[model samples]
Target: MKTIAILVFTAFLMISCTSKSNKIIAQKDYDKYMEIKDNKSKDFAQNEINFWQAKYDKAPNQTSYLSQLASNYSKLFENTGDVKYLYKVEALLLQVNKEYKYTAVGPIRSLGRNYISQHRFREALVLANKALAIGEGMKETQKLLFDVNMELGNYAEAEKNLKYLTNKTDFDYLIRVSKWNDHLGDLKTAITFMEKAKEIAVINDNKSLKIWTFSNLGDLNGHDGNIQKSYDYYLKTLAIEPNNSYALKGIAWIAFSNEKDTKEATRIIDNISKRHHTPDFYLLKAQIAEYENNQALKSKNLSEYFNMLNTINYGAMYNKYNTLIYADDKNTAAKALEIAKIEIDHRPTPDSYDLLAWSYYNLGDSKKALEIEQKYVVGKSFEPKLNYHLATIYKANNMMAKVAPIKKELLKSTFELGPTLEKKITNL
Candidate 1:
């Protein structure tokens, strides 16, 4: 039986903060259980602000109050997809760090988490190391360190830290285990870990935890070729947080890829784009319009996506997407190469290397691309997306013989690869 791992925190919310029953039911029942109070009237962030603000007013210098306030802002950022809350979190944490002499482990961990959210892995690593050095938050700090090392492509170090952190059966341990297995391309094991984590979260009656786990389960199931399960899980997530952008995006993908309903997909994504203001949603719109051969719609959505990217000035946060966009177009090849180099300098992970190699490939340097692929990407990753890129890179270099094995592996997960891409793999 495939275990449904509970969705846990995103990498951004994985630090210092933070389930029970196992009852299998039908999809309809699952949706019913997922239904909860409508979240729109909750004003959860404002409530948090009121509580923390009152506490802070009582004692302006209290590091504890300030730390809680920073955490609240972090949640607010996640809730609203707004950078202003992130700015508040950073400032509050910095104030706490200075006032507490950098010895306050909680504030340091929280600040490090904020940095991680912003994709500043190196800075987060520095703080993680400091927390570890002071012997504060050893387990949580070590977890943060593990995550940072993974982002930076220090896989060996990440594994060592992961081993140390996986000795417990808590939510953190299970979720991290799930993520580790996922990274190693063991989707089954990852889902098992997530299921256990989700079970615990449910038993504990943690709404946020449930929302995270359900959303993740939906994605995992979708990636594992179980469309109904994925759709159900996404519904469950929406039931908890009606305006969840992540859940909305997942639903949109299911509609487009599995259901082949581009109209529904467009509607879902448009809702997400209006609510979340995320540039990637516009990219999805572009893809849908491309499939329909609506060049005008595609151009409009692509322009909107780029406009959003430009407005955000997201820096490294947008590096991966920017590299993809640049690599796909000859006019942007040089810029893609530039972004790829910066990404490799920052992370050097297999994914980053893949992007760098792809940039080279797009620039007509197949030999350079092949070298990068062999050294960093080929055997290091199990992601079908990267494998497809590898096969294409080999084909570009006239290494037709080398492409067969990758095509074979990719064909095994046709459903996960989606119909459009499945057709491409068949041709390959």
Candidate 2:
């Protein structure tokens, strides 16, 4: 039982915000929820985020307004694929609970999403339980509870919630079950679940669920090392939502990983670049330039990346490009250093600690990197990327004797690449 994201705009709008002007602003954002659908609109969501952030400053503990604001931040987090703001959102929700007598399911669902983001499946399950206990008659949020349980490796609980998904107003209910089934380690079962959702989305022409299902299938293929199949799935996804910048990035990476066709990869990369300003697009340009052996262009683009990471406070935007989009380990080290400074200074969380560790590891500071990595690895399972870095650092420090067990584990991971993952095995 996967939980559909019910924006709950109307319900949230009712309790939060008293000022007519602020309500008007929230209405403006709600309009876009229905009208806008493109990666280009990522920044537009940011603008709404800014609006809510400003409102938060003016009225700090106003539960209604802050709850509304938290929702917007959650949206930004989803778009950027960064989770730091999740910790921030959790903090805000706690504040909401403190200020208002009641705890709402919206904030709980948002936090569960964050836990899911971090891959802290068990923790997410616990929080989802809290949300379910507090939310009466909110079937969607209850489904979210079931979703987290499924993610937590509890298949039976997810199956129990199937009855609530019957003929949902939105087909996301079906899609959620499919993903939960996928996580349960039964590919055949997962496909059967998704087939029902796909059938409904196709019949109704639900763009959101159509794109969602296709992208998911693409990831499943990629995990199995079926690169061409994954590539074709991604192509199908883009046909549904041509401006889904994330999918565009995915296809470019597939081209790079499978074909290494500079022209084809660069074309996809350029597609992401044409969208609204993102620190990532510039980084992609740098990567394209590097692939072309255009030293001057590469240097220029890298310089922009440096500026964005150092000078600009793109917040999640900086991390989106520097942290998530790029594949070059060494270059990521530089960007990570800049990101660490900002994150640790302006805010701090497990992710910031991990970023600093990766930067230090890349810059040859094994001792510092090891210390920070040790602190971060507790919650690091949510982040397989960090495990790769840790393996690299351990091997470099003559700790292969300690790394062998982890290497064996990595070799069998769902995300493993044959030779690519082999490179991490110490003493192999």
Candidate 3:
């Protein structure tokens, strides 16, 4: 009787929690909750910014104060995804660099982080290298170097730096290990490392860290064809930080890709776009338009996406997206090839090579594409999108035997491909 009662109570609790979660808080209610929950953090960040600003104002020539103020602005920018805060970050950091002749490791490293946030990876890499030179043997600087190297597709160099910084108990180290494993085509090992990192975050009681881990695990699970798990993680992230743009985007993808509900996907993204002004949001809208067979809307969204990209200093930021847009459009094959070459020149990773091969295939150079695919792309990445691209390339090159296995693997990723693309994949 005791065991039965406990089970009944557990089921009741589950139902109660689900009912509460299903009660959609109106926008007003959500706003009230956020105002009460988030204003404290916002006000705290502003207070720090004011404090640092006063110090910098009093000592106009003090580089340390300038760097501190810049860091506060960065914190504000991160807390709120406002581009204006980034403008201030760039200005203050530039002033500090000018005063110190770029010798101060703090400002340089901070500026590199800002560049990374803006998707200016090549610029970030240059500044990271400078930070390393300025602060040789510093672990933090080495970590920045490792991240920038990975962004640039310098896998060997990234690994070298990572080896010097790896620590089992360190959150950043574990996440990096997960990313490296993912890049090396080991999804299972990658997920294990990410889960370990998430466990560490939970044990540390770090809410921000937990949010980051949950969002990343959501992405990893999505990539690995675990759609329900991915959706759960995204929901968990939203439960903590309701305005997390990445989690919103992840859930929006679940709506579009897994649920085949374009209207819901549009609603989620539209809500997010009203809050966050990221260029990728527009690109996603374009993809949705394509899926819905709205050519005029797709072109309009794509144009808006490019226009938004032009306004931001995205150094090597959208190469992958550009490659896909250009190659798939066929009319832009030469442009795609141009971007692919730039990607390969910056980071000769397998994904970059894959882009190059796809560009060649789009340009009707199937023989060259096949050669590059065999030499670089095959067995290098387990990404479903990469596999789909490779399989299509194989088909174009008359490799019929190679097509079936890849097609079989890809069909399992129906959620990843979205309903429209999944239908096309089924045809393939």
Could you give candidate 2's per-residue lDDT for residues 304-379 as a string of tens digits? Answer: 7677567644334245235432324665567668766655543244555666776787777888888887776543
Give candidate 3's TM-score: 0.83
Candidate 1 vs 2: which has more TM-score: 1
TM-score of each: 0.88, 0.54, 0.83
Candidate 1: worst-modelled 10 consecutive residues by lDDT: 11-20
Residues 158-195 of candidate 3 have per-residue lDDT tens digits of 89988988567687788878878877868889899999
The best candidate in terms of lDDT: 1
Candidate 3: clashing pairs of residues = none
- Weakest ten-residue segment in model 2 by summed lDDT: 9-18
TM-score of 2: 0.54
Per-candidate local distance difference test: 0.73, 0.55, 0.72
Better lDDT candidate (1, 2): 1
Error of 2 at 206 (Å): 2.6
What value does the lDDT take at residue 331 in candidate 3? Answer: 91
C-alpha positional error of residue 370 in candidate 3 after TM-score superposition, expressed in Å: 2.0
